[model samples]
Target: MGILKILIIVTNINTYAIGNLETGLWLSELTHLYHEAKEKGYEITIASPNGGNVPIDPESLKRFTLDEVSKQYWNDMSFRALLENSKSLNEVESESFDLVYLAGGHGTMYDFPDNETMQSIIRNQYEAGSMIGAICHGVGGLLNVKLSNGDYLIKDKKITGFNWFEESLAKRKKEVPFNLEAGLIERGSDYRKAFIPMTSNVVVDRNLITGQNPFSSKEMAKVIMRELGKLK
Candidate 1:
């Protein structure tokens, strides 16, 4: 089989209004997946709503939170360039990739939902049978996607994202606009998560896959790879 082509979508929103918090793509969420995909010989492309210099969530770059892989990615100039020069969503074709990944951060809460171009790309990719994956708030991107059958993309699908408890635990309950868990439930998705918070939790339903938090990043990539028959 030819190398799998993957498109990674990141958030452009950099600051949260509450506490004026700094937010962007979680570095580990993107790096863990990118490292795994690269090792598996997959072609990876980074893109965003407006593209250009995708932000790394400030909190995620903290020394304590930085895992070895993420730290390596932070120092890798070549990899950094990919994030810096991500293609604009409008400029990429869905058919070119075999998989789509939504990297998470609080910032995604602001830009992932209700973007016509992002929705179109997702809709097209879904119809084309490409695998779709998202972690944390990145799953917000899937909320508004409606199929030609006039049903929400996640309707009746088993999915999970940043749960309500985690939001409150993170002390952003009032900061974020809406509850992601509630939104998924309202859209008819069978949302599931880890019994314990901040652990690796991933749910795969047909062509769609979702993770609960940044901790689920590597596991999410493994699931994607397994689905692609590239992992044992």
Candidate 2:
């Protein structure tokens, strides 16, 4: 196929209620996939629920979270500009991309689940046979999408996300508005996760792909590339 296009969705919320912690898109979750896709000549677009000036989780910029790719992305002026002026989700069309990726951060718990524009894009893209992938808490976006049949898109689909234990490990379990794992299960998703918390686990079920945490970002990108016929 011609140059494949990917749309990446990031959260707009800038803070978590607990500890007034700063939160936004996990930098590695976007940069790892972005750099890999760019190197392969894929076109990528960044968008947000309300658009413009996407937030980077302050914690993600810390030394602990800064991998080589993320460190490079931090200093890349052009990439920073692209993120600073992301397009609004309303401007996205399902027909415009070959894949859609939801980048994760704790802030996603507050915004991804209830945005109508995001829900529309996910539903439309899935119906159009485009691949959909999300990592960590970003999977929250898929929880609310309904297919044309009025059924939950994730129903009976084997998927994985930031597990409950991870939240507890991060010490935000009680602070988050709802339990992501519980919510996914309640919605009929056959949610599966890594036996060991924080492991890089990725699950592919048909058109949908999910990764358990930031550690899974690179591997998830490779899977997306394979699914798009970019790799063996």
Candidate 3:
């Protein structure tokens, strides 16, 4: 097999409106996925709405970060360079990658929802048979993707993201752009989640993969890689 070109999407802010901020891609999500896929020799590229030095939520990194991964990640020049030179949403084409992994952060709610460029990239990647995965708020991108039949790609597919309950526990319930689980349901997603406290929970529904939080990133990637293998 050749190198697996993975496209990672981060967030960009739209407005400095009250309570809205530019949160960086979740470090745990990126580190977990990067290390696992790098071990397999996959080539990864980072992309954001504007591209260039993706911001990271320092708070999420504190709660989700590990010292080892953080150290190794910061030490890698190539990986750091990729982050610094990520393509802008408009610069990315669907056929350029074999997989697309959407990383979640508070900023995603402001940018991922209605970008025409992102939607096009998603449609092309999905139609071209690429593996698509998202974690936490990253699921925002799929809210409006249409398939070849002109149907919402995630419609009726079982998925999960950062639930409102978790948001409440974190005390940032009212700060988010929208309730992700509710929004997914509003768009006809068959969203499912485990019981209370929802730590380390993940759901894999066909080619649509999702995780409840940063803790679920690695497991989600494992599921995605497994599904990719089965695709052959």
Candidate 4:
């Protein structure tokens, strides 16, 4: 099989909508997924809606959240540089990638959903038979994506994202713009969650793949690799 290409979209907003609640890309979400896809020899492109200088949620860089993958990349100057200079989403042709992955963070809620280019990429790439993967708040990007038939991409499709409870646990319930879980259901998605909170919960609906939270990164990445391999 030929090497597949994946577009990993991160966030440019370095802070939350409210006060000083800093939020951006969750480090583990990007690191874990990137490692999994890279090991499979997939061509990866790190990009952003506005491009240049992707931010990391400060909380995610705390001692509690530091994992081997995130920790390694956090300290790697080259990796840091990648985040500093991400490609503009508009510059890339959606057809060039086999998968478009939205990496989760509170910042995504601010930009991913409303960006026409993002919706275009998600809608177009998905319609063209490419896989669409998103984790945590990154699933915010899926909220407004419409299909060619004039239906929501997630309408009646099984999906999950950063839920209200997890947001409460993260002490960010007030800062997040809206309830992601509620929004998904309102959009007619068959939303599901892990019985136990903060566990790896991933769901697949056709070419759409989503993870419930930051903890769901590793499991979801494996699922993405397996599914993409099947496509090849």
- Whose TM-score is greatest here? 4
**Local distance difference test, each candidate:** 0.89, 0.89, 0.77, 0.91
For candidate 1, list the clashing residue pairs, or say none. none
TM-score of each: 0.96, 0.96, 0.90, 0.97
Query: Tens digits of per-residue lDDT for model 2 on 1-232?
Result: 6788899999888987777777888999999889888988888999998889889988788898788889998999988999999988988854467889999998899999999889888998888888999999999999999999999999999999987889998877877878999999999999999989988999999989999999998899888888888322
User: What ranges in model 3 sit over 4 Å off?
Assistant: 14-16, 19-22, 75-78
Q: After superposition, which runs of candidate 1 have C-alpha atoms over 4 Å from their true positions? A: 230-232
Q: Which structure among the candidates has the greatest lDDT?
A: 4
> Please, what are the lDDT tens digits per residue for candidate 1 over residues 3-102?
7889999998888867777889999989988998899888888999998989888889899889999999899999888888999998885456788999
Task: Please list the residue runs of candidate 2 whose C-alpha ends up more than 4 Å from where it truly belongs after superposition.
Answer: 230-232
What's the lDDT of the predicted structure labeled candidate 2?
A: 0.89
Q: Which tens-of-lDDT digit does each residue in 1-232 have in candidate 3?
A: 5667888898755332465553667677777777877787877777898877677676655634654675578678877777777789777763578788888877788788888888888888877777788888898888988888989988888888888888897676767768888889998988888686547777877666788887687687788777766754
Give the distance in Å from residue 79's predicted Cα in candidate 4 to where it truly belongs. 0.9
lDDT of 2 at 83: 90
lDDT of residue 37 for candidate 2: 85
